[model samples]
Target: MDERIGLRERKKQRTREAISNAAISLFFDNGFDQVSITQIAAAAEVSRRTLFAYFPAKEDLVLHRIADHETESGRVLRERPGAPLATLRAHFLDGLERRDPITGLNDAPEVLALYRLIMDTPTLAASLLRYRENGKQALEEALRDKENLPQLTARLAAAQIMSVQWALSEDNYWRIAGGTSADDAYPAARAAAEQGFDQLAGGLGGFL
Candidate 1:
């Protein structure tokens, strides 16, 4: 029974990866707005229903990985060993050092192309906006009892913190997109991240 379950999980993973690869190839060749779900299904050799099962939305075919880190801020606030703000700061700084894609510091050719594709495509940008919004709300909930602050203050703090990260990441992406190597951009990324979090903590001292 355990073997059967493991086999089933492996098959599911393969299907998901196949779908993502097919959809991305199609999107790369034909541009995002010009492609349809049926076309992607055909390219992936999966029925439209199966494709939807693996990914609820077509936009997710390329952006699913980005969604993975969206909940991290909430987790930090909820399970902090020290100051929640400090934990969040350290987490992003770690991403910067590691050249995490979410931190927009990855200089790999494929990563740059993928980032450009998202920026050039309207639907993907909108999907990313939704993801960021969801992350903000999650952080807000996490911050509710986090600092024992007023409700309005919690909401404001969440917004500010999320915005800081977003702002720094966007700046990094722009630099990389403009031909700056990720290594060349590392200093700015690290400085921006540190300053952003420091400003957040300074402005809202409850969490610090």
Candidate 2:
């Protein structure tokens, strides 16, 4: 029974991936606005109903790639040992070393293409802002629950951490987008993350 359930889950994941890949390919070739639900559904060989079952909105077809990462900071804080800020700093640095897309240190062609697509589309950009805001709220809850911080303190810390992280990611993305290789940018990216976290530690010294 468990084996059957696992197989069923894997099949669902494959279907989802096929639809996402087809949609992204179409969006990359013809602009995001030019792609339609019916077209993507046809390309993926899935019914429009199946596509909607997996992804509710047109924007989700693209944004789903990043949805899993929205609560990463919260998870890191809850799961990792040691100071919250230090754990987050270490995680960000590790992501840079791994060329993780969430850190914006990835230089792969597909990653860069997706970044360009998001930056070029105002609607996608707006959706990303909302996603970031949601991430901030999740982190705040983690701080309040895990660290036993006051509500206001948790809120402030989460905002500062999220802002610093976003700035670091944007800087890394632009550096790679503007011609710098991820390898070449690694040293500076590491330094910036260290400094950003250091500043955070100082500012939130009492709470963190």
What digit string (tens of lDDT, one per residue) describes model 2 on residues 115-180?
999989998999999889999999999999899999999999999999999999999999999999
lDDT of 2 at 79: 91
lDDT of each: 0.86, 0.95
What lDDT does candidate 1 reach at residue 140?
Answer: 86
- Per-residue alpha-carbon lDDT of candidate 1 for residues 30-100, written as tens digits (9 for 90 to 100): 99888899999998899999999999998898898677877779877798777778888988998999999
* Best-fitting candidate, scored by lDDT: 2
* Worst lDDT 10-window in candidate 2: 80-89
**Each model's TM-score?**
0.94, 0.97
